[model samples]
Target: MNLFKMLRCAFLLMPALFCYSQTSSGSTAVVSLEICSNESSVDLFTMLNADAVAGGVWSPSLSGGQGIFNPAVDNEGTYLYTVTTNYVTLYEVEVEVSVVDPIAATTTSTTLCSNAGPVDLIGFTNDTSNQGTWVPELSSGTSVFNPSVDEPGIYSYIASGACGTTVSEVYVEVIDTANSGISTSLSICEGSSPFNLFDALEGSPDLGGTWSPPLRNGSGYFDPQRDAPGVYSYTVGNDYCGYSSASVTVSIDQSPFAGSDAVADLCVNNGPVDLYAFLGDGPDAGGSWSPALSGGSGWFDPLTDQEGVYTYTISNGSCGMDTATVEVRLIDTNNQPNVSLAITDLSGNNSIHVQIPNRTNYHYSLDNINYQSSNSFTNLSGGKYTVYIREIEGCGFFHKEVVLLGGPKFFTPNGDGINDYWSLFDISNIDYTIKVFDRYGRPIDTFDNHSIGWDGTFNGNPLPSADYWFLVNFEDGTTKNGHFTLLR
Candidate 1:
């Protein structure tokens, strides 16, 4: 009884041992069987529903004096079994099975350096123990566990280990500081007015810097009051990097004063009067005197100086000067000389004599000489002479002089008349030429002798009364051109 119990116990524990062995060795479970001597053969099947056994003869006289059967496993749980020997057989067996779970694979990245000065690898993990670690592909640096990008461009990181290396792709972009430039605005007015200049700088974070004018050294603030009018240029630059410059133009105008409608009125007896000036609006608004007038500004003289019309100008040193005019007229006093002289033909012959009427008790002189009526003068010289007439007026002598010479000659071309031909007497010493034209400058008659004159006829034909021109040339290189009228 004790032996049977021990055998039963062993039989119960057989499946547990087989299952444990299959699980430990990662293999399929085994099924055990026991056959009697009377049994010829037995079939075995797998736990996974397969036709694993076929009927066969059980031979005890086989190679090990016993036969052992094994089962094959399949995908299903149902199994098949068969027996081939009709003999005494005791079959008590245990089978074991097993199942396994599939495993999944993963990858990781690494960064070697997180901060690399100006070149920082941004947006990347810094922990090397994380899934992604940075590895620099550049020829100069090693792999970084954590990476940062400060510059722009494509960046790569590789996580390397004894197993393998994994590379992660990343792109880094960086922004740069803007360069400096300048914009300027200048406001200038017309004439001699000051202007204001303003400037604006680009990319300058703080409005603090030094400004330098063109053609000048050092840097300072720009003030228009300190500078003159012209083209002014300046440059604004930072201490480290950026620089900009601009230019502005300032114009100044200076104009002079002008006067208008200035006039002066003065009497001939009052002499010349000084002209005054009034200037118009301009930069040079003040009035001044020119030519150093004795009176004041803008003065002129007419009496003790040149007479007739006089003109003076007033200016303030500007666009143009204004002018004023003064006219002088002489007034007759009638207290001066009023002497008269005349010449008359004495006879029908070509004889002329000069006479002065009402000359009683009056001393007379011809050509600065005393003349008496008792001294009759004939064949008188032909020229201009001053006939002086003096009268004793209350111990003070009253003298009057008259010019009497070179008077016109008269002729009347009438058949029954006197003075029939025009002739000049006592003028034979002067070189003269007389020509008569019939209004068309065509010579009708010509005479070279001073004593010979025109008779108002051409080729014995009488000409109508009209004006005729005469040109006389003297031997002393003097020429006299005059016009005369012929009377019938």
Candidate 2:
């Protein structure tokens, strides 16, 4: 009976030994795993036990299963497990639990035209790791990204998890360069006409741009209807990209109304009359007129008034003139024609001529009682004589005093030959002293001697029959300067 009791006690302790051995087996080791939240990259942490199991019962203590470890997160072979047991026996088994971070996410950097707004990258992420947590390095929640920088730079994004983190960068560039140019045409001349360049740069962009050739009639923009002829320039640009410029040449035409001439007529009767002119036609055509007149409808007539000849001129609007002239006369009214006599020989050598009214019959003689068909008489004796003229109902006479004092007829100094030298008349009683001068004002001769008479010679050279000046002192104390022709 005592031997039976000892065997029974051994059988009771066997279950307890199995439980201890299983708990201390290799299956009781702790294991762990990690995963990135953004990229889903996984990492494994394995714990191996040092004891072997004898029974098939295993268990693990809470304190023994807890420990810190580091693992590399990657896509290759991500599964991990661990067994837990009580004591040295394999009593129970348990698998390891892994805590994965949210999947890592990534975003593509954006490219935009210059001046375009910022890009939104809020929802961009990498979900390969099945992680929910995402974080940004360059920006915060709902932050925008701007790739349009003044200078080129790189953009970056980063995601992290309990296991690891990832980094990505994208190159970005901003450009605002543009082609700038201009064009225009112009017409010019030598006058005061308005210039225009409005038509230049038509069909061009003007928003956020500036135009030159400042507006004369409208805004600074070049509009064909607004600008005058001239030169112009234009510029355009963006806030981030800066600006560009272009030049345009404009031309304007000369006015047709330049340099016009005006003309009018001034008549004796009509003071000033309108004279129509063509634009640059006649000597005085083509001009503007005050109180305007119709073309070719202006004129003047002299019979309208009795005033003297009227005058007018054609002028260049600024300077210069062309002129014209006219004349008038009187009429005669008488039944008996008028007649007059004249002497042609002013030197008084017995030569004479006459003139009579047109369409008249007349005659003349040296005596009042005598009449002849001859109209002239010549070479008569040097004495007082009467000249008579006879018309149909009347006869008229004129008398002239003549004295042949110093010629061959009166002062003949006859010796055996007749009339050879000159002799003095008895003019001493008339209080006369004759003096003669040469052409150069030199006193050459004087007639104070009673018997001295000139023989028409100077310095023994016979004087020619030409006019010579003489001085005669009269009895009245007045001097007479006379011009006479000498006769040979």
What would the per-residue lDDT of candidate 1 be over residues 420-449, giving only the tens digit for each residue? 666444445456565555567887766765
Candidate 1 has a TM-score of 0.24
Candidate 1: residue 7 lDDT (0-100): 19
Q: Against the correct fold, how does model 2 do in TM-score? A: 0.30
Q: What would you estimate as the lDDT of candidate 1?
A: 0.39
lDDT per residue, candidate 2, 362-416, as tens digits? Answer: 5656655566666766654333334655553332223342222333332232334
Give TM per candidate: 0.24, 0.30
* RMSD of each candidate relative to the true structure: 24.1, 21.4
What are the Cα lDDT values of the candidates? 0.39, 0.41
Model 2: runs farther than 4 Å from truth? 1-105, 108-176, 183-185, 188-208, 212-231, 249-251, 258-484
